[model samples]
Target: MSCHNPAAKIDIPKEAKKIVLAGNPNVGKSVFFNYLTGLYVDVSNFPGTTIDISSGKLNKDVVMDTPGVYGVSSFNDEEKVARDIILYADIILNVVDAVHLERDLFLTQQIIDMGKPVVVALNMMDDVQRNGLKIDIELLSKKLGVEIIPTTAIKNEGLDKIKDALYRAKPGNRIEEVKEIIDKIINKVDTESEALLLAEEDENIIDRHNIKDFNGQREYIYKLRRYRVDEIVDSTVFEVNQNASFKTKLSRMMLKPLTGIPILFVTLYIMYQAIGVFMAQTVVGITEEVIMGKYYYNFIMNILGSLLKDSSLIGQLLIGEFGLITMVPIYILGLLLPLVVGFYFFLSILEDSGYLPRIAALVDRALTSLGLNGRAIIPMILGFGCVTMATITTRLLGSKREKFIATMLLGLAIPCSAQLGVIMGLIAPLGLKALIIYCLTIFIVFVLTGTLLNKLMPGESSDLLIDIPPLRLPRLSNVLKKTYVKSIMFLKEATPLFIIGGLLITVLQYTGLLDSIASGLSPFTVGFLKLPPEVSQAFIMGIVRRDFGAAGLNDLASQGLLSGPQLITSLVAITLFVPCIAAIMVIFKERSWQESVLIYVGSFIISFLTAGILAQIIM
Candidate 1:
């Protein structure tokens, strides 16, 4: 647990020690991390939900919440990060679901072998009890050479004990004894398990950087584990009850191909309607009209404008009809706020019910042909919320090829909630056929591009490894807390960009750059695509931020400048065009400047070419 990296700061307070909440996905690690840190990290029931690390200060100490990984191997990028952190942590608050102890224990064994400071957070104990499942925590603790604290993170139960345990615990040293115990446990494992175990512990088998040798060292660890399994199992503990219940049968049915596909469609339909339609439409409508439209906008414009009336520049910049102030209230209330809350609520419910992995499994074959695995579905689904986050989540994909394709698809095809919200609002009056074409156009592009990318990218598709947890009723407290956190995240991430984009447009309009660019691009807009020159201005706005661009288009469309074909063409072009500034920035951060530029230029070329073609066809 100690490190000689002098630059690395480990501020261990005299009173409290840092506790890291680590576990596989959907095990309430974030809820536990949030409970300890007193900061809301979105805790969804879905696996691969948290791609990037979210750390917060916990009572004078820091608590880091790592993305859930099934193993501590370098097979995937997220797992590698998790492995590195576990290797360096002072203590691992390993959270496992009580109901799915066996499956959860798979990762616990990997952690125990890594020989780091360890504590078992047996989370979701209530679920265990409800299902008539019993775990001998003491026995399990002894078997794994770690402390076990049964918890219900959703209810905030056992958190004090978790805190107390960390406070009292000393920094961990590599457990030679536990490592030997893992050796014995490996003997009982099958060839597959042994291969994985050895590969993880092997010093020479590099999963990230190019390795001199591709030969796996998994067999060596398998031998070591086989030699020690009996002692570990004997010292540690487990109890098995095989009496099948209704939940068990239901869980099986969910994974089966026959019944699962229909269920998945129904679930997706409900999710789209609930999050995309109801939340984006009804809730956003209420907030935008009742709050921002009626109160905030009038007050800001009138009061601020009157105060700065004599200073024409200041008045126009701060409180003009099209200033950031005028846009801020609407942006937050109409697009960002409602979408975050509604999407998170729906996401939390799906996550809690353990349907996410099943969805992945159902879609895995399709994803594989698209150059991704079932796991890629997580980021692809999240792309609807924010491509920036989804871009970061390319780390979860097993291969570089898969990651590249996923990132590209997300950047090119996925429309964030803000974009969707604004688009829905603008096209609402245009009828369902228009909306359907808009939807179908983007989806077809996603699939076609994904299929082509798969053929072009050189690599075997990754095998889908998914864990399906028992379906449980989502706890209301957890749902609300998660939704609240995501809302805050959305606002925090989007607001500054929205304001800056607004300011940039205002400046462009004032400085005549907008007119020059619009004029330059007018041929493409009016002549090529048969749209007004102003639509090209909207495309410029879209590059800065998608919703801002959509709002600008909304202005033109409302003025009757666009016909049906032109509106549809503009929508398609804007959606397929370069990602918003935020997504582009994320791509730059996660990948590189070159990749980001490729995304931007490639998207622009493809979008415009397609738009021109589509305009001709429609015309």
Candidate 2:
């Protein structure tokens, strides 16, 4: 079958052409995207999928960026998104890491076989030469039947040639045997891209095209293509030195058990000091207490009180205890904002420096006992940022079983940064023993719950298969940009929820519902958990937002309503309580309504039971 264009499948202006940037993970695709599009970029989920795609303008042409993938097929959501974009784009910018030319060429060849117009960006050229490797750019271009541009994306080298190379892009030569097999199925398939996918036995494409299954043919075609890719790399690339560098030695140490474990703890300690001690305490005190509490809250409440009077319902709604003016901004802007910034900033540094995957590798074995691989660490790490966003990210896990276990763990055990910060501040004053007990209890719960679920849940777990990128010094500009974007996204998503939560709390208070619920929960609070009845109010606030609950507890502790043991018990209970409303909604969206509800109910039981037992022992 001749190459068929799938560009017509998606709607775009007739005059507008698309240039898609595609490559394997950590191949500098983002750097290229930022270079081409600069600061003007929009990140959104692709239609009908949770995978995010970034788009921006390059001169008059629309430039699009796809999630990183090894090859173009529906092996995962990211690959599916990448394949769809490649299918629809007018041209492709295939970024290849020159140092890993042999490994990256497989995807490069797959794109070529799709008959899509492609310009090869042989990226990481500086890394190549620094490691004493070389590539014959012209020879590689000639072999693939596409233009090759050697680029060091970080240094902004050879980037200007990209625009001109777009016009010089060409389809890669196809394998004759594979072509023959595709020709036989040509009448059934509509596009060359679809044909290639079909030949690879892609179920999604086959189902979409209503084509017959070609199961055995895929292995044959894949092997043939792999052979061709090997031939291309062998002929066009040369490596001068085989000696391991310090980075290589460090990478080895990071993957080994003894060294890696200590490294992991040290890393966590550093993060805790940076985020928990410095940012959460020092930065948050200024932002939440001095700025928001002493200034903004007072300023706004005074103005609103004068305008509507303290007894007025409008005044209560605006500036009262549960008022939007008093609580919402303080919780979101003053409290959560600093924590989110600090968390994302630290995360971005780890991500850009290529340390995250190594950490994942180190933990893979331990996670396996919980029916997860190191891949679970991504969402777990992100859960520390925001469990709601992490729930959505659980889709990256391989199976429904993995996703369910991960989601449950996140909902039940992982406290978001905002809540963590407040919890730390509250527990820190109780002395080191209290703090250690608090952390140890949560960690024990996390492992035990995961182990229990692993046994109960059906299906075997998948192993971790991840790319380990070379460590590089993080770019300040890139790290700051990601931090800014993620922070803005957090604010936009969180602000409205906080306002709604504040309004809901005010209405509840005004209608006497808050008091009634607190009274109703007194038996559970006072009798079961061995805490003051007033602590029930914090539990109610937790349903609105996790941080709100923790902050409420902080307020009660400040007033001396909770003792050291009571503080520890309450912190543990709230930490494992029903996930905040936002997280529950996301769980409902990502999992089913049934699953979300079960998780909600299950967490409440587990949290209360655990806390009840702890309160009895500790007190």
Candidate 3:
């Protein structure tokens, strides 16, 4: 919903025509919206729904973008919002994927049957050519009875033609059923759009218009409409070659479990090198130790030191080790920022190249065993970057049971990017054996916990129904834009959390509460976990930020405090600990307070109990 704009809410001129851009998912509507709107666009939450509607101006016409849907119906919030805007549209600028003529044309035909003026942007024609498919544009135009502008949205080809053709858009051919339905219901409804939706048995539309009652013809109408679309596609599209392209062949390899699992590992290994090893070890070493650790620290302290010299208490709060000015920025910018940016950059590429969905499809079987479909992998993968953001992504899952299970797993097992970086660094010196132990332990926990939850939870996971767009080289400009915006959002979210954590720690340290708490946790920390009392301090810090906890352990390791087995045990425990404050807050926001508390307490007990058993054997 976000990351693209510093866009101010724009007001449409009262006299302006509302031009809607509608299409199936991944048909390149956003590209067209960006080109047409230039740098200025508005994303406003549609009334009475959580979905946002984007608007920009094209001359006197107001260009709006709706969620990509097969048809406008009230099945979901996305469809309902799209249905409303589409209903009110003065002209529908339908963007259709040329390669998906039969599938994409169904919605195009739906709009046409509603008697709404619409212009078709027959997009991805370049893909159509590369895939060895041909479409007769003249025949398609004549068949649909609308202007069909073949466009390659990425290359900016035929865009101007689409803009110019808007003025010439008119209603296309209507089927016999639509004409008959309109004749029966036109006097009852205010608009042709409503009549079309009512014919489809749209409950919301029927309620709004106060329809007495009508028999459901939705299934029959859909069957006929699909038949009509297939008819048009049969006449207009042709296969130029019988052979599959190389990309097509590779895509198949990506879907099969045999090749796909290895490909997934290679992708994960690359990500680990880039974000965990390179960004965490190399980039953070320079930024944290050399830049912020020495130069910026000394410079800021020197200038501010003299200013706060008179009040020792004030100086301790502002310039102390846990000071907001000292620790917050250092951690957020110097330590975490590079890792976050790297992770987002990699994620954007997976999304843009269309490989993310393939990963989901490949893992569907494995995830199904965990009471989740392949689609749940999106949030699971995202949980590594930031559990807070991933919690929001859980809304994408179909059922309440799936969302609850996904949220629980994320809170319990997944380590965020910042924490993952630090954890990787800790495990690096422990060698390959320790690394394997760590991976095996976490993997076992993930599987065992998920299986138990599946048995305990009612209802079944929904099947993965996702789009797999033709894989191609991702556009660099698009990828970078996504990375930059998402990184900015990360900084914005992390900044406040770090500041509050630093401030709270400063207060606790000054009041002697931190030491007192550490003393109080001696039974659990020293006796149960068999770690030193100082390790309790890191556990406390881990509550604020998991990476901070791991970094604290790193400091202990640097000082030659923790033995190897103890270090490994502590690492396992901390990695499985309750999520950081940011993630905890998000869990509370996403789930009920009862559920949130249950996850937190459950993770705490599981983390220590599991790690404690390992401590007995290893240490």
Candidate 4:
């Protein structure tokens, strides 16, 4: 929605003032937002973008948490959104990282130039002090002509001061060069902020004002403002020593190839143990076999049977093999839920501990071979959570070609946690050798596909230019809260898809289409993949949901139908197959229908061929 149209997404009262929380990336803006809004919050997608905007109440004011950006301009989707919100804000709570003042003050200067009432939440004061640096806050405040509230947001320090300072907020002094330009447009615009934006040639502001285009003098203004920021820092900031702290030393080790590679593997192994063994085997077994299968499923089936006999369509639809009540709940709640919780828990820990960016840095060199940089690691890691969401995150990558390559790789080989859990459980019985083979096969396919796409896809991959946040001990409350939120989101998004898949299966079974398709694919399934004809059903289910296919294989393995080599072959094929229908639809939405179709068909052919070759050798 347009920033001017707060009624579209925000539920602020007509008389309520707008308080915008603004900041550079990773500067504790979200933490501040949470503290101000508490539990009263609404998150919705911006009208035409995938970016989510969060709005909530702070006392009587409507507080908005905007996307993190460096300076307010239409450089990208995120910057554009943040700029719009800034333009419309009555008062701006500009959160700044004390440790990264040199980098962050650029945005602060931009906000000040907008002539908006602003209160600087100088966050991360603890980190700043720990790093042997100190800021003369009073002096800095006088220099910037704004209230600077020193805060350690995670610790809830200086939060009350922020609220108290809000009423004391005043417009910051404008940059001299920008002021001259603002004077030129003073009659054209009502506020200095609008004039500054107009001088920057912001298209949205230009359109709103119906003003003629002016040559943007953004670079000249930026350079002048940047010099002033340097002067303020030099006069008001102090450093005791340049010694690297322990966290910095550790961060350095994580960037080196030798140490970083081992660290990466150790991290992945830990994740696998947590999700694969603990959650998949132990937790899932308890939930699926004992609670659901032994007790809940039986109880539900008995109740359904009593209500409608087994021969009835309603009874079959409720408790039959592909029944909504039986399969949907069992698969979603029992099988996938534990895995989702476990995966998100570990992911939240890593994210909160600030190690994910280090991982991106560590893998940057290797990813170059895949026609991606470290930034692509974000989507790849996210793919493990949910390929559909990861598909949307591909926007973070640089070019269409990089996005295409990343999307293709994700579709071809990345298995989401739910599918990985089932695949782990199914293959765990075959011994470590079998699991190793399965992993190796998928890795080979991933590397080969990425390398081939790198060669064929015509474009240059962007270099990695990411800000590395300092490592901090993860807060248990924050980690748990994140896990809960992400888990709920996963359930909300995945439940309907699982239910729909179950319905599709039930319809196919009732019409004998499932059997017909299985029979038709027997030659390839049985002859080439060396899998039983029934395993063909899993391949079909893969299109509906990748984990559904893996779940189907789990059922076959449980029934003693799939042997060691056959199990490996089946898992390999399914893992390398196309992602779920949701991901394909997202691909179509993000890219083009032609690209989506090509990804689907290409993945299928590659998966089948790879599985066939591997099956012959293993057999």
Give candidates' CA RMSD values in order: 12.3, 9.6, 9.6, 9.8
lDDT (tens digit, per residue) of candidate 1 on 1-619: 2232211343435565445667888888877776777753333221232355666776666677777877666567676556555555667888887766545766766665655567788888776645645566776666666677888888988888987777544322223544554465454333222324344554312322333444444534533444444344444434333554667556656767798778777887787677667776788778887678768877776777667763465555666545667777677766567876777777777777787887887789888878888899899878878888889989977767777888888888887877876776666667888888888888888898889989977877766655666677788898888778877888899888878887887777777898999999998688988888889888999989887777778888879988887898898888887898888888888776776787778888888888888888887
When 1 and 2 are scored with TM-score, the better candidate is 2
- Among all windows of 10 consecutive residues in model 4, the one with the lowest summed lDDT is 1-10
Candidate 1 worst ten-residue window by lDDT? 1-10
Backbone clash count, each prediction separately: 12, 1, 0, 1
Candidate 3 lDDT (Cα, 0 to 1): 0.85
Instruction: Give the per-residue lDDT of model 2 (tens digit) for 433-515.
Output: 99898899999999999999899989877756567788889999999999999999999989988888888888888888999
Give the true-structure RMSD of model 4. 9.8
Question: Where's the lowest-lDDT run of ten residues in candidate 3?
Answer: 1-10
> What would the per-residue lDDT of candidate 4 be over residues 33-76, giving only the tens digit for each residue?
88888999989777767789999988888889999998888779
Better of 1 and 4 by TM-score: 4
Predictions in order: lDDT: 0.71, 0.86, 0.85, 0.86
Decreasing lDDT order of the candidates? 4, 2, 3, 1
Displacement of residue 378 (Cα, Å) in model 4 is 1.8
On the 0 to 100 scale, the lDDT of residue 488 in model 4 is: 95
Candidate 3 Cα outliers beyond 4 Å, as residue runs: 1-69, 74-201, 208-242, 305-312
